[model samples]
Target: MPKRTIVLSLKDQDIEKFLEYITQRLRGSDYSLTYKDGRIYLTIHGRPREIEDLIRSARKAHGDFMKIHKPVAGVRRYPKDWLVERSRGISLSLLIRA
Candidate 1:
């Protein structure tokens, strides 16, 4: 089954690395990724279990450097729609530490 799209935010520092990490983790799986408005959008075709696993792994890998915002399950939509519907006051901010 084709799962719904999910949106997640990553710290600027983790953007590049996280993309690589996620791409590898999802290898041989049915998933698509794109970035826009500073957020990464993931579209996967699989059970929620697999998707959830990806989320957990991502959180663990970038726990200290990234922040993730997930939508309530069963709400199906693309990233843009999810953002508008959820309307969480959350904002993506990137801080550079020298």
Candidate 2:
């Protein structure tokens, strides 16, 4: 199994839509969603293809309210170290391992 991460920038009006989009796709999946510092962060445990599909769907569904950025994939790593360095805002950082 691999881990994937996605970062999305959204306006106040679009947060609910984004959450709905994710909830629809990620039903019964091993995933986590969190909002902090004016950003939406999604962490999922699944295949690369599935992850990509989820991101694409999310963008299409919430495109009007949110500006979806490109997804970043890589070897799995702990976020604690990176979080410490980032400013008081949420950004997308991914760690994926085979």
Candidate 3:
């Protein structure tokens, strides 16, 4: 089955890094990434477990980044469970560290 994920970002470099991050982590999964307007559409042909793993990994990475960089003022840091809930069947906008 193919799962679609949407990522909203302004910079192409960020999107590129996001794709590189995902590709490096999920080596076994196949991905088709494209950008339309201001959002990135990524289609992955992988298992449900893989999707969950990807989201979980992203959450961890975000947490680690926050620990080092400290989130900017007014930036909301979502709870772990909220991140999982927001996945909504593997569809979400990535929180990239800037």
Candidate 4:
């Protein structure tokens, strides 16, 4: 299956709780989660149904934060190695200014 990604802008404080919830829900599924510059990046390597399910669950759990997030214009899947490098390169200071 082709990989898919979702980017969500939220408070840094909420990350731990969000991660716990998502990790629990995706216990038996294949997914990747990362944080960069106050944005949460989730990648699910699965079917459309699974992806929708995950998003729906997230919305229910974090609707307020989701509503305030900038809608993702486009989502492109980069290689795993590149993802790590790219996200790491995004500094908090740059994000604060943006």
Candidate 5:
């Protein structure tokens, strides 16, 4: 089944690199990635476990870029559970380090 909607914000210049990295990681996976309203909305079609793995891997592997783009103050983190609400049906809300 398709995963819940996820919106990612990437500066114009960063989009290329982000897409390159994501594509490489998800080489065999099918997903919907689009740019709209200055955000990259991605919907991954996979099992819940698969989605969890993807999110964890992305946060661990590609998170370096996230660090570079973080705010001047405070820390950036991913919650223990990406699923924010039961009604949302296991949605992963990705807040880019920006």
Candidate 6:
């Protein structure tokens, strides 16, 4: 199966709190969290159901934060190699904005 990625952009928000919340919500799931270019990347290599569940958790987190902070947060998905391209010095700013 193709890999999947969930990209989260949180501007002017509490990173620690968001990380803790997402970590708790995604317990037992196959995922890795990383920070790069001012964004949080959640890379999931799992079954489709697992991916769906993760997306739901992300939405819940978004909603929870929206109620409290309403910070500039964007939750997006991208091809598995999006990170790879970024790492290889590719400009994805255009893609990101789209």
Tens-digit lDDT track of model 5 for 23-58? 876678667789976688777778988877766665
Better of 1 and 5 by lDDT: 5
Clashing residue pairs in candidate 3 (N, C-alpha, C atoms within 3 angstroms): none
Best by lDDT: 6
Candidate 3 lDDT over residue span 54-98, tens digit each: 656554544443433345685656555445654666634453332
Model 4 CA deviation exceeding 4 Å by range: 64-98
Task: Give residue 80's error in model 5 in angstroms.
Answer: 22
Better TM-score candidate (2, 6): 6
What TM-score fits each model? 0.48, 0.51, 0.44, 0.54, 0.56, 0.59
Q: Give, for candidate 2, the lowest lDDT window spanning 10 residues.
A: 63-72
lDDT (Cα, tens digit) per residue for candidate 2, span 1-98: 88787777766666776687568646777777788776788787779887777667555544532323223373233334333444355543432221
The candidate with the higher TM-score, 1 or 2, is: 2
CA-only RMSD, every prediction: 14.1, 15.6, 11.1, 15.1, 11.9, 14.2
Please give the TM-score that candidate 1 achieves against the real structure. Answer: 0.48
Clashes of 4: 0
Best by TM-score: 6
lDDT of 1 by residue, 1-98 (tens): 84767778755566787777676656787777778877878877778898778666544544423323323474422343224435555542211120
Superposed model 2: Cα runs more than 4 Å off: 64-98
Q: How much lDDT does each candidate structure score?
A: 0.59, 0.60, 0.55, 0.65, 0.63, 0.68
- By summed lDDT, the worst window of 10 consecutive residues in model 4 runs over 75-84
Q: What's model 5's lDDT at 55?
A: 65
> What is the Å distance of residue 93 in model 2 from its true position?
43
